[model samples]
Target: MTCLKADLLILAGVICLSLVQRGKTKTPARVMALVMTVLMVAVAFIAVPISSMNTLTAAQDITAKLNPNKLDAEIEKIAEIKPVLLFSPKCPACKEVTEALAKLDPKGEKWQPVQSSGEAQEGVKYLKEKGYAGEVSYHRYAGGVPVLIIKQNGKITTIYGKENIIKAVTAPAK
Candidate 1:
């Protein structure tokens, strides 16, 4: 599944690039081409290719190899005001977390919703379609879906799983 998705993304990139080369220089098309190019680059950087059947260990390896300083800087830049909730609509666990969070933040004001997936392509589409101005940190923390990144006291806490996400968000702040 992961390979298929990646291949599809690459095909999309090729199509966009061909459009750009064939004089489809309108702003939206060019912008999409650029975005697709960047996403392809990010896909290349993914530490491990996580397939649907073998995601657990690969995601853990990616999580373990995460650079804290780079991640901290990204969190401060992207989620400085609202914590970033990285999720995938296709994931059952992510759906549960989103449902639980909706109860806490009825107006969706507590956290910034950023789409995530085993591949890096989903977040870019989510940001563009949602008109979100934040950056895609999915490639930075690809430890499965429903990952909530909270920055408190200048520290970054990456919480995974539906239950842990609920508990962390509902917990009393220090």
Candidate 2:
């Protein structure tokens, strides 16, 4: 039933086995049993959410920095020219793309960041404080972070991600 109770039961069983085997007077069996029990407990913890707390915390930190309202306007602006958008967060590859776009005539103004999670009010507040005025759309991608879509006329055209996002965003009209 409960995890603590289960762990205690398992630990008790291991201790009992260790003691019973020790009654005959051997040392190797006792050591092996202790090691096995420790390993089992370790595996149990690794297979659970406790091990993933760091990753979840990092994701939340990243999500906290996004301005959703600005994202909405960036999407609208991009849609006026193209139809799809490729985007990624503040990773090195995405930064490379941003740098490449910066070299273009009009740069950072065309891109937007979409936070994949967190409270909508916080996101809106962030955008307002940043003075970002745009039509924002809050939606998740199929299996990744939220992607901003820019539609030209009625067709989807630009997509943004960690890789090649700059090239996709800055390419000539097609």
Candidate 3:
């Protein structure tokens, strides 16, 4: 995804530079071309990989599989701050959980409902890459959502399904 953005940026910069170069007599145009060149170079250096495109794509595909432990760790971290409820917006069960949590913890203190807004894969990618601790190699999680992870009796407990989530969230803290 990032490489795709970099490639697009480079392409746009090249097009802009070419257009600017066509009018090289103007000082502003020359400056713009130089700026575009520098911008493209910087983006390439920072985002674009030096490896072959196939190699990069293959590597990305390999890394794109979600690491369950990382997902658990991320949820655990969120649970430390507040019990985390991972929900998918489009899911019916998740919707029920969301409503339950909304009514249960209006102040957002008792429960933190993290919306895994998009598809499961995208959600996992978002969580892994830009989660509570950013830049972690979290990948696509093609699993069921509405997962409630909390600390219960000194142990971290993960509850799945809408009924279990509702029960766990509503239960008195021990």
Candidate 4:
């Protein structure tokens, strides 16, 4: 995406410069054009890549979220027996978990994120990408949400599918 943006910027600069060179007469106009062109070039080279990376990292959290060990270590911070739902607003199956969670924790006591509000979606996508979503006996999940996890006694249990999710959420934490 950054490369595309930079190529577009370069193409635009070439077209605009051609027009300016053909039409302009004054040295002052030429100098101003040079200044503007330099600024634009700088922006294309420096700002575009940085912004693109920031956008991807912030939206997907892909690189940082792929490690299951890291994910487990973080989940260990929450209560001994609480439901952690990996949800993305876009996922259809996540809706059921959300509803179940609402009932399971009326005061929102038993549920939390893999990390936070939007990061869980990114984590779920990471899990799907690596084929870790449904490889285990307990997890029959395959590239879908919500992935309901319960951390109890330093153990992480992963659950998938609507039926499993209903059971995971409603089951009392031991």
Candidate 5:
């Protein structure tokens, strides 16, 4: 059966149990109420999908931001920090992540955005034209964007964000 139908059946069963208990029991009404409350709470808790829900929500937001045609400029900028951002023009989640990154305004920093294109050679040419000196990496995933890898000289650090990219980018250099 469908999830909606199953939920309706569970609700009906709870109501029936409550009515039957009221008709047949001499038990205190307050005690019965507490038992019903506990059962409802347990059922509600079990109905939630807690583990991967947040990840999926984040991916949804990220997917809405990708723009393949404009990616070369963004990637060149991100490369200044470290040449890496895994992006696919066709992925909804990747688009959303790109939008989030654009909102970061990582200006004056050595960070550049990198988007993967099916036409790798053309993409490389575009990156070079935009002044990106770092190597371009191709990505096939349609979900989360790769972590932003910031490299200064020889040290490298990875970071990820949707809501707090500004805070992360503006924080004092470690």
Candidate 6:
């Protein structure tokens, strides 16, 4: 049944019950009806596609179908690098990391920190969107921002924030 119809029926039921109860059940029934109305409104609003809102959405819709194998493989290849920096401009922790990375490197060898459009999915979406062919690291340890993520053979490790970046830099390579 349509949600609008169902909500209407529920509202009618609540009103009728309140009338029968002579206002004794007025508060409870009215509350239930209000809850139901809000739920219905939420469902309707959430049902609309965020395509218009999501700037990351496809710019042009391609009508022709294409194979995803070549694309996925290439993306996986790039994502398999030992460690990659994922950061967004919106994160303060990322700002700290960026500053440290800038100062820590003389030859630009500390780590390559790439600026992502935003940090959603730890900024992995930016990598894939830009045609990176490897897996996106999703390690939960300090996963928010300024993360040094290493992915190899299905294993993911993460070191979070600026302090860790300094430690990794000062430590000898393994």
Best candidate, lDDT:
1
Q: Which runs of model 2 end up more than 4 angstroms from their true locations?
A: 1-115, 128-131, 140-142, 146-160
Our tally of clashes for model 6 stands at 8
User: Cα deviation of 26 in candidate 1 (Å)?
Assistant: 56
What's the ranking of the predictions by TM-score, best on top? 1, 3, 4, 6, 5, 2
lDDT of 1 by residue, 102-144 (tens): 6676455566666655557765554444444445455344445
Q: Which structure is stronger by lDDT: 1 or 3?
A: 1
Stretches of model 6 off by over 4 angstroms after superposition: 1-82, 118-143, 151-154
Which residue pairs show backbone clashes in model 6? 74-133, 75-132, 75-133, 75-134, 76-133, 76-134, 77-133, 79-134
* Lowest lDDT block of 10, candidate 2: 83-92
The top-ranked prediction according to TM-score is 1
TM-score for each predicted model, relative to the true structure: 0.47, 0.32, 0.45, 0.40, 0.34, 0.38
Tens digits of per-residue lDDT for model 4, 1-174: 345566667667765765566444555555766676777678666543445455433333432344323444444454254676666544545655555555555445555534233434454454444333321112222222456667655676666666776776667655
lDDT of each: 0.64, 0.48, 0.59, 0.51, 0.50, 0.51
For model 3, the superposed segments whose C-alpha errors exceed 4 Å read 1-67, 70-72, 119-142
Model 4 clashing residue pairs (backbone): none
Ranking by lDDT: 1, 3, 4, 6, 5, 2
Query: What digit string (tens of lDDT, one per residue) describes model 2 on residues 67-137?
Result: 32233455466467543333333333433443444354232456554433455454445444444454333
In model 3, what lDDT does residue 139 have? Answer: 23
Candidate 6, residue 75: how far the Cα is off, in Å:
8.1
